[model samples]
Target chain A: MSAVEEMIKERLKNDIDPREFDKPEFQRDPFPLYKRLRDHHPVYHDRFHNRWVITRYWDVDAVFQNSEAYTRGIYEEEGPYKFGSRHVFGPNILEYGRGDRHRWLRNVIAGQFVGQKLNDFLPVIDMIARELIDKFRKDGEVELVTQFSHQFPIRVISNMLGLPREDENMFVGWYQALIAGLGFGGVHLARGIAARNEMWEYLEPLINQRSKNPGEDLLSRIIAAELDGVKMDMDEIKGFVALLLAAGGDTTDKAIANMMYHMMYTRPDQFDRVKATPDLWENVFTEMMRYDPVVHTQGRRTVNEMALYDEVIPKGALVLIYLGAGNRDERVFKDPDTFDAFRDDLHMGRENRSGRYKDGKPGHLGFGMGQHFCMGYAMARQEAVLACAYFANSLKNIRPKFKEHAGIFSPNIDSGGFRSPAELWLEFDPE
Target chain B: MKLRVDYKKCEKAGECYYNHTVLFERTDNGFPKILVEDLTTDALRHEAREAIEVCPTGAISIEE
Candidate 1:
């Protein structure tokens, strides 16, 4: 057997059960199973997780759009409603809140991220990407994920929140711990609780200082922001900051790495095309997101018993909206498996077509749709596109180093929900 | 083609203004402002259509 095949087989040995979606093998390549679910059981009830997994594009989009029928249920006392540890208090984080509260928080937060505010962050993103690339430009070979991709977003977010640059390593550690806590089982959950407490302790004082001596950063802006003349309290401010750090840092980090991985390994021809046509970087990033989004699934709850795809999902049942599956659904995408940057059938960015037509294509549900659509969609896009453009413009002969060692394109693992290369080693000539 | 924005439905995603900067500009409050109410040139109309297609909330519309 080939060395890479043997390694993969050894990894898959522990994940023998095909139905276990959380298994490492399933996480590595869930598309085959996703195709099965979509074809045979569109509304399959996962008995293990006790949730209905929606795989079809239309059904997933419907669930996202119909917020009233399927609420986030973020405030519910028990189950998966509580996003973070119970220790954190004040108003629920924007994602967890429902109804008017969600709208109010969303508006307040969304206001800080549009147009000029976003444009202002472009230079900051560009500078960071350049600096990170410069650090390893002469190294000849670099682990892109750990050394660059994972750290860039955290630094940018830290700067935005007015956090000290020297303390970025601390924030990264806290983020890792907190995420570990959010993962499956008790040990990770305990770690998550500890991380939350540590984060709260660290942030409370900073939030207090911002409340009194507010600066020109996002933390200060959020502190001073008001919805209908009611300002957010200290705890709410902390919540927002935590959410920003977590979402902005982790997701953007993974996204940039994923895009690069796709370019270097999965779609080198497209990468060459992008290099030939520099302007296509934007389209490349858009298509990269549509083809293989970082966020694989989002959790929601049915507000009431609703009939969908011939299955009557019960009230208060947890629903896993399989965005990765939806992105590749054949009914929605032509040649869904193929990665096409110039696919005319797909809307590029934060777009949502009213209806699907032969000439008209709806945006992928990567950042989601409707009221709960990702507030950071534009910011993420800008960061990714800029970082990618810089790499494409600056780096020469960039290619995956794993191919020589193991005949594998990428060493990255999907890990079920989020898709990022665990460690992306690439060799590039300095420009 | 006449362009209009449904301000109430607009979440200020900013796709329209960025995609068609010549035809739309952002107000002080960050919402979109139609730079030219009636776009006569085909290029302007094309840009406007692209902007409309990318609006997440479907806030922008072109009237023919």
Candidate 2:
């Protein structure tokens, strides 16, 4: 190649160093790199990472929706290995892929989180928001993560589970440790298991109590939940509850914190619109999910050799569907990188697992569509929106505590892209 | 083959209608509406099976 040809070739190169994913700059702002992936290498085979990356919106959706080609279950069912033996949260519904048990568990457990059943739990959400806000309202300024966002969701969950109000702090501690313990092996895993065991022991009596005399709480519902004469046993019940505390608690808390971080920093002008109209908090949540969601990537493995854009991916290949990248695909979304809540292209309404919306607009893949879609989709959205609106309405003139912020980050490359600001400090007068 | 959508278990994910529009279409609401309940051809049966398999909720099934 000539000199001019070489320079042009350099510009045309779509190569993405796997190390870039680990760099601090990528975590701080990955959209530029995401755009590069979308524009050039739609299906990137990262040899270093031992995974295939799909960045386009529709491709991610296709993988998520197609159980015929891909599976969320990483472990082989027929293997000598026990399922969920090494899972951070233990044996739970998530480890299963397209099976009768998964369907059964999803059927019974999912209902409690949606429709009128979910509506019944609304009061607990509002009550917790009020309680948390009340504590920091006097301080005039509070760290959203520590003071409000972190505490609110877990407390709501604990309250919904009918756990003792006084033990809410313990629940919070265990969840934090549980989340911190995951994706990093050794000491983190050890601490996580310790926390899980401690919480499991604490839940033993509660599960027994609920089973004997069921109440309106979530724990009771799980214990009493049955379909086709099948019910979750002791380990399953406790495991699900613990998973909820970590998975549900982890996502919802980070969501609230992310929204606040964006509103107070990324889009203060747009934040004004939401403040004026509390209902706009829904839009903020939706946009935030697309813009910089709590969960950025979901892991799925290909079950068969499949033809992607140009290359054939072999069966049993690890595919990392980068929802964050797909959310910013210029093809599916207009002005993809810029966060615009009122943008007319997005669904901006209640999302479904199929990734298809009635509005003819595509939905964000943050929750990961299809069978294994975020089971807590409605609950997470409800909790995050209510808490945000609660914060917006509860705190008058709430603004960032400091003019300079470190912005949102994943803390570690292998953290699996659970992005949230380390600390979100906001100051506002008591409502 | 006759198709049945167990509405009780259905989350209205649109997998059936969205994926196979001829066999199933959207109702007045977002839930899937089976256009042709009876399938005789192998192609049609294959499509129905695909819908059943893709459904996040095990709502779709063959009647017999």
Return the interface RMSD of the candidates, in order shown, one decimal each.
10.8, 6.6
Q: Given candidate 2, what's the lDDT at residue A218?
A: 80
The sequence of per-residue lDDT tens digits that candidate 2 reaches over residues A1-431 is 89999998897676778888788898788888888888888898888888888989988888887865898877766777676578777778878866657766765566667767779989889988988888878778888888888888888878777899999999989988788777677887888889989998998988887799998778888888876677877888888888888888888988999988888898898988898898888888999999989888888888899899898889999998889999998888898878888999998977897676556688888888866878789899999999998889877888988999988887543332489988888888754
Query: What is the C-alpha DockQ of each candidate?
Result: 0.05, 0.21
Report lDDT (Cα) of residue A82, candidate 1.
40
Indicate the worst ten consecutive residues by lDDT in candidate 1 chain A. Answer: A407-416
Model 2: residues >4 Å from true position, as ranges?
A: A1-12, A227-230, A412-417, B1-12, B15-64
lDDT over C-alpha atoms for residue B51 of model 2: 77
Which pairs of residues collide in model 1?
A181-A192
- When summed lDDT is taken over every stretch of 10 residues in candidate 2 chain A, the lowest stretch is A409-418
Q: Tens-digit lDDT track for model 2 on B9-57?
A: 8867875664576788766455788899998888789778867776767
What TM value does model 1 have?
A: 0.79
